[model samples]
Target: MSEPVVGLVVSHATLAEGLVQSVRQIAGAEADALRALSNEGCGPEALQKSVRDALGDGPGIVFTDMPSGSCAFAARRLTLDRDDTAVVCGVNLPMLLDFVFHRDLPLPELVDRLVSKGKSAITGSCREVAGHGDRAAAG
Candidate 1:
């Protein structure tokens, strides 16, 4: 069997850690396949080292909170020469949940699905729904 794909969440401050905790609460046992790292007070070099240490030598995915921030930059730098690595920025609960469910997919396919799911999850409410109505309209 193929080695299981690993997941790494990288973000500024405590976002990465918090997201992982939330994922654990929501996903239960499935969240065990993931890890989180924060660029709290570390420089690029230190952050890169942390990511590399987390990644080890296996096929993995890195999710960042920002596309151009330090976390994404470090992740991009680390995966630049490695085909087995992929970095998906703008991570959210939807994306992480998708990863939790789809971590066994091939690296490239998983990255594609993550990017699509993450983008699709970002939406604006245009009208009232069954359980979700605009509070301003109600008040």
Candidate 2:
């Protein structure tokens, strides 16, 4: 069986390097994470080629740093007309960590779980102060 792959796409090579380091810092040894990014003097096509070369006909997931940027676009193109691979943008620590943590799950289930976790990770807090600020004074 092929080893499961998780790839990252970034706008710049330096960013890609940092992502590799950060992913390892967060995920430890749970996954084989690779990266593709636009080089200092290159363009979006460079990112696309990087992804294609790294994936090389494998069942893998690609995560891009931006939802509507070159990196994301490249990943989308790479996985076009293919289901074995998934291209997900909005890459963040939570999502990447979740992917590695749940690597053992079956693909379909994993995807469902990841989406749920991703949504939950985003927060928008709006509430009145509780015991520490209001309720204690009220009661």
Q: What is the C-alpha lDDT of each candidate?
A: 0.86, 0.65
Candidate 1: stretches off by over 4 Å: 30-32, 126-139
Write one digit per residue (lDDT tens) for candidate 2, span 62-114.
76666776777777887776677777666666666777766566666666777
- Cα-based TM-score, every candidate: 0.87, 0.70
Best by TM-score: 1
lDDT of 2 at 138: 35
**CA shift of 108, model 2, Å:** 3.3
Across 62-132, the per-residue lDDT of candidate 1 in tens digits comes to 99998897999999999887778999889999899888888888888888998999988876655445346
lDDT of 2: 0.65
Candidate 2 regions with alpha-carbon error over 4 angstroms: 1-3, 34-40, 126-139
